[model samples]
Target: MKTAARKTRPAFLDAKRGVGNWAEATEWLRDRGIEDIECITPDLSGVPRGKMMPSSKFTSNTSLALPSAVFRQTISGEYPEETGDFRYDPLDGDLKLVPDLSTLSAVPWESDPTAQVICDIHNTKGEPVVYTPRNVLKRVMQLYTDNGWRPVVAPEIEFYLVAQHEDPDYPLKPPRGRSGRTITGGQSYSIAGVNEFDELVDDIYDFSEKQGLEIDTLIHEEGPAQLEINLRHGDPVELADQVFMFKRTLREAALKHGIYATFMAKPMQDAAGSAMHIHQSVVDARTGKNVFSNPDGTPSEAFFHFIGGMQQLIPKALVMMAPYVNSYRRLAPGMACPVNNAWGYDNRTTAFRIPNSDSAARRVENRLPSSDANPYLALAASLGCGWLGMTNKIAPGEPSYKTVNEGTTIDLPRGLLEAVSLLESEPDFARIFGQEFIHTYAGVKRGEFETFMRVISPWEREFLLLNV
Candidate 1:
């Protein structure tokens, strides 16, 4: 890969400073006649957690206050026992949510004309909250900035769109007439045969464009009713925002068309699973040069170190990458999912792949993560690993050239328990993700896993009923 000359852009040129302060935000709201605002913060599992507020109060208030204990709440809305009596006091204390003004946007698809703003959690004393996912990513970004590096990321998201059944008690409804039918056959990127879903795709594209989103491409994926959408590369924070918005937009668009969209990694037992493949690189902040470019235009040492860090931390970060119980079902070999921790050039079978492209376009593609991952956590984990590798000068092991589908000899954690155990024991994970946060996350996930284990499956009932 040959290094290409980098183009320069003025500093602060692209900064989104649409709403500078509460006063301006309020005036803007008044002009637009917007009456409601949603102050959203990403929780432990990357789900939005916050309250809807009257537009006047939301824009006029100097600072938005929330309970700090909301961070400690379980994804299912329960308090963890570890908090003991501390949780009650914290719930009563105020944690201010200062708006990230750049994130203010109107919900184009919402019928009631709502506005949204992403927030950074702060203690009542005005300091940044340590455990919040946004704060975690911000810390990681600061580390990169301190090292004179800027991370650029682009993510490819895969999801499924299914017709919403007419009745909850009835089986899934067949598509309306022959033209509006869903894909029953597993077609691997057949553009000609995918015209049946053109209406849905067109709607999605229109919706995304209306929201000022930059979606580069959309195509049919390997599974029936599965689709992949790719966004252009940008700064890590902006990329994560795009991911969050993309999921929301897809769901809203689907619902408008009388369909449902899911980002679940594996919805069907035998179907190909959805994945979120992330492409990443580092650039020099001063010169705007790509630091990952090698002298010969191949992947540079920085790039190798980044990939090495990802490989080292991947096993431990599985819980973050694939948070749900069903996420593991997509990791089987030969199914286009990564079952082993390996890297290769132009190889899709390996967990990490350097796609065959010109030096200017070279990037590492991490294929292990499912569509269910929280973008903030995923980016933080990747940055943490990269930071560690850079600081320690860790070299990556030799690349595995063997095809992953043929079952290369490398071993990966077999299940969620193994994944969680690996994460808990990783040396620097506690330092990157604070022990308190890690413990809380582990407890919540473990509870979910235990509940899943106690359930009797349909397969078990069918097999035992006749055999016994």
Candidate 2:
């Protein structure tokens, strides 16, 4: 019975809410009676890492520092040994947090009046910390801007609602619904399934509105207790910020409703896996014209090149798109996920699907990334590959008309370590995403895989304990 209270939109929550300078941010905070500010940045794992301080001390000129080592830390909280391009500063130096006032918004779930702003990481010399996930995204966007092209993206993220459990050893179960029955079976687009958790869904909407995030649609996915949220398309950086914030908002809202929401690529066996499908298109920066279509309204060469780039580079860029060990679970053949980097028009099984639309709305939907991916890194890699394609005029292969099933040769990395190796060995990605970041990301992922290998799984114990 935890329903959100109806409230009027806050004045600070305008369309231009976060576009103003620090003075405007201060005014907004003051009007909302914000007591604290959460200065956050997305680390390699997409986890929010930063300090929270009293609003009185936050300003445009406020100097805050976090260790550069944060970017090198693995998801397991362990650091890999210094090797090759993976070494961090011996002093573990500080990186300054320069708040992007455009990302400032209220933390609506908080009882205390609080605000959160995403920050840009900078070294002591004021150069961008290129490995930070958010900064990595900005670096890619800069490439598009330099070429007079502006990339736009819309992400559809899927997740599941599960009963709260503390033990990771136990398999997750779908949470009980309003009828007090556990959710079961496929509920794709089921209105009743979505309405089962109507109160929680309301909170999610309320929270997103307060944070200036927009939800295009919410629908029940094919998996039990699974749901997907689509975000409106716009600038890659802003959409990344919204996705990052949306995850937090949904999780918080779920907790309040006495359940857990998970974005794991494959949180359960026998159920469909989760994915974050990105719909992308580039436009002439000056004219806001869709570059994928010509004046004749036919598919432009740039469109094919973008698909070619995705087909050629996504295999190497898999580490960024599917970052975790469990992420590979969602990419297996026959899982309703793409196993190859095939391109096709309106083909759900291919990695790149060009949806049917008018010339002005032409775009490619990248169906490879898992829900566990860092939104910033995912968008950066996806857009970076497309940028390379158009610039180099790479030609795409013939589109597929059939499903890429088990018999098809998989064009993607099958595991996390393989993905990391593929990424590290690809010089093109090193040039695009930076050698330093590639090294650090590979190192961290390698460490995570090693940590996972140390664990004994249920399958091993169930079958191998006596048989082996």
Q: Candidate 2, overall lDDT?
A: 0.90
Model 1 residue 142 distance off true place after TM-score fit, in angstroms? 1.4
TM-score to true structure, per model: 0.88, 0.96
The alpha-carbon RMSD values of the candidates against the true structure, listed in the order shown, are 7.1, 5.3
lDDT of 1 by residue, 347-433 (tens): 888888988878777778888889988888888877778777776777888887878657544366767777777878897987877
Model 2 per-residue lDDT tens digits across residues 117-229: 99999999999988889889999999999999999899999999999999999999999999999999678999999999999999999999988898999999999899999
How good is model 1 by TM-score? Answer: 0.88
lDDT of each: 0.76, 0.90
Per-residue lDDT of 224 in model 2: 89
lDDT of 1 at 327: 86
